[model samples]
Target: MRVSSLLRFRSTSLQTSIAKQQQYVPQHKPAVQDDIKRLEDFLISKPNILVLSGAGISTESGIPDYRSEGVGLYARTNHKPIQHLEFVKSSSVRKRYWARNFVGWPNFSSTQPNATHHALARFEREMRVQAVVTQNVDRLHTKAGSRNIVELHGSGYVVKCLSCEYRIDRHEFQTILATLNPAFKDAPDMIRPDGDVEIPVDYIENFHIPECPECGGNLKPEIVFFGDCVPRPRLDKIAEMVYNSDGLLVLGSSLLVFSGYRMVLQMKDLKLPVAIVNIGDTRADHLADIKISAKCGDVIPKLFDFRKTNPL
Candidate 1:
């Protein structure tokens, strides 16, 4: 049989799977079979679907997101992410940030993609998805084998010289960090969503932040930090992907951040179908053609199977 024949999802089995994963399902408004059916229909109708993902998708992978209620980093703690201007302007801030990041790096770097990420990768492999545009700095999608991806906020897996634009893999940078802070212990209160931790002031005072070896300039993670704009070229690329796709499928994002929210707006402007599968109300809820309040991990893995639907 053709591989396309395996794409149809058995509704009863899918629903049963969703029901079995109730621990991961949202309590407020769990997704019904109808919602899955609609989404399945949407996927079949729109072969070249563009996925716009956010932090929620990685939460299943043990990384915290900033905005989810009660469980998110913001709700659970008073910490805020490093702002771009602050990191650029203050030496002390960078010192503190790097110290925390050094402590948290191992745990953050070890995070593996969960079912949602794997499912998205499968979608791309099956030619159902064109690309995944993620606001997350974590490269979980790529780690999960998604090749056609646009890291809208850049990635934590890369470091760059702010002055000269020289880039290096984050692993190599971490090795440099290890050499610089050989005495630093790995103790942390907890790892924050951005792969940093709340370290003691003493650690910050003693920590050595690495400068770019080639230029003696500041080294920064390639992520688009809060209060910074996404580079124009990345925006253009995402726009091109958006224009090329027949529909938009949002997974695990509240879309409160304008960077991810604007994609939904663009899809609406293009008169394309927009389907969202998230736990709570998203900024684009009113505009979405279908909004299913369910965990992406629970629902996404069941999206592809053999049950018979219109051919893509």
Candidate 2:
């Protein structure tokens, strides 16, 4: 699927008022015990499992995913994430993005790692999972104490100067942004994935975005925006992670994006055991040795519940 279509922007005219928009409450099919048992058995058979996680893993933390059945960001709203090229080429787009992000950052940045993240961390500590490659930019795995992690999409917690390579903590950048546009106190219509939100255009007309302190150039989040390629160096690192693993376990991702989907293909090519735990069908579902359609939170913690007395 083309990235542009995946994140197609909803025109301003089509946007409904927040009060008029139907609120999306997340729901999932009840997890089957049989599937959970199968996943546990799969994990037991493979000592060095590589975990590939996605946005669904973070949804239980109160963040939203992009493609969950009825509660995903795309399903809830007409808006989609910003296109990287548009952000880089248009000052107006940057202003609007920063404005909306500024409104949503407090909640997004404060989101904590949930049960699924903690369970994954425990699996890593026990040596059951060798590495975690996450498509999420939220950095919840780091917060959950997973030592070895590869953020397939770069983090949302860092900002970089596009022209000068200068970097700043996202918190510090938020402060700078706040100081620059003190009058932008407009409340957000809704919070989207990656700290983005839907805000009125009027709120953006006078919004002031800060430039790089060093080179007076553009400041952008460190995340790989929609329609952008993951840096080659990062890709190489992930490739090495895949090469070193004996098993592949997907957590909470639809694998709609090629980057994550390619890893599953690699696992198949290597003839490694592959399992997936997601709420819906994934692009690589047919190839998965075992596919469980359920929430990661409901399923991941149970893996450890069965092992609590036994210990891995």
Candidate 3:
């Protein structure tokens, strides 16, 4: 999904608005309980499990998944890749991007990790989950307490100089952006889940773009933008974990992106035990060993609850 499609955000306010707009679908209904039960038992036997996650895990926290029905996070603009070239080549475009973020930040930043995130955290406490390979940039898993995690896409919490690679805290970058584009502080009106802000091109043109503090160069959000590739190191880390694992539990992810889908294929070819919990059709459904088609919010909490309360 395009960054813009995710949501217009630089902070949690963006999260509040998205939560208000999107409805939480009840998950883990009867259609998927058997699979959930089987998955719960399997974890008890294996103990050492590796978890792979995507946006679905974060949806319960109020962020919208890219492919879900209804007006998606990036519905109006359509999901289009925001490239490095556009940001560096056109000041107007970059300004608009920042403006969109300024208004959308609060709603996006306000989100908390949900039950699935906490379940993983609790499971990790049992010393069973080996690693967390996630496609989400939301950092909910980390907030939930999973330490051994690999973000296949870079995080949104930082920013870098596009020209110099000097990093800055996203908070610092936000200050600079707000200072330079004072007019845009209140300009944004639309929010998306991936945290992209929707603002007008005219507003962008009128805004003053900020320069990097270190080199007086262009700065971009420290995230893996669409059309940009994940570096080799991140992919290698995921592959290493997945290949080394006895089982792979894909929770709350549709596995649509090639970065993730390729990993799934890698696991399948290696014949690793693969299971999934997601609400919609996914590229890996046919490939999964145990497919539990349900909402993760309903499923994960219940799965853990069952593991604790019942003998199964």
Q: Total clashing residue pairs per candidate?
A: 2, 0, 30
Give Cα distance to truth, residue 266, candidate 1, Å: 1.2
- Candidate 3 has a TM-score of 0.83
Reference-based lDDT, each prediction: 0.82, 0.83, 0.74
Root mean square deviation (Cα) for candidate 3 = 7.9
The worst-scoring run of ten residues by lDDT in candidate 1 lies at 18-27
Q: In candidate 3, residue 266 scores what lDDT?
A: 85
Assess the local accuracy of residue 237 in candidate 1 as a C-alpha lDDT between 0 and 100: 90
Please give, for residues 161-244, the per-residue lDDT of candidate 2 as tens digits: 899879999999888887887676546445544334666677788888877889999999999999999999989998888889
On a 0 to 1 TM-score scale, where does candidate 2 land against the true structure? 0.87
From the highest lDDT down, the ranking of the candidates is 2, 1, 3
Please tell me which model should have the higher lDDT, number 1 or number 2: 2
Best by lDDT: 2
Off by over 4 Å in 2: 1-26, 186-198, 306-312
Deviation from native of the Cα of residue 8 in model 3, angstroms: 33
Could you tell me how far off, in angstroms, the CA of residue 54 lies in candidate 2 after the best superposition? 0.6
lDDT (Cα, tens digit) per residue for candidate 1, span 1-312: 555555455656767644433322234555587778879888988999999998878877767787777666677677698899999999999998777777778878888888889989998999999999998888899899999999999999998989996999989888888888867745544454444466667778888877788899999999899999999999989988889999899998889889999899888899998999998899999998888988787678878664434455
Worst 10 residues of 2 by lDDT: 16-25
**Per-candidate TM-score against the hidden true structure:** 0.87, 0.87, 0.83
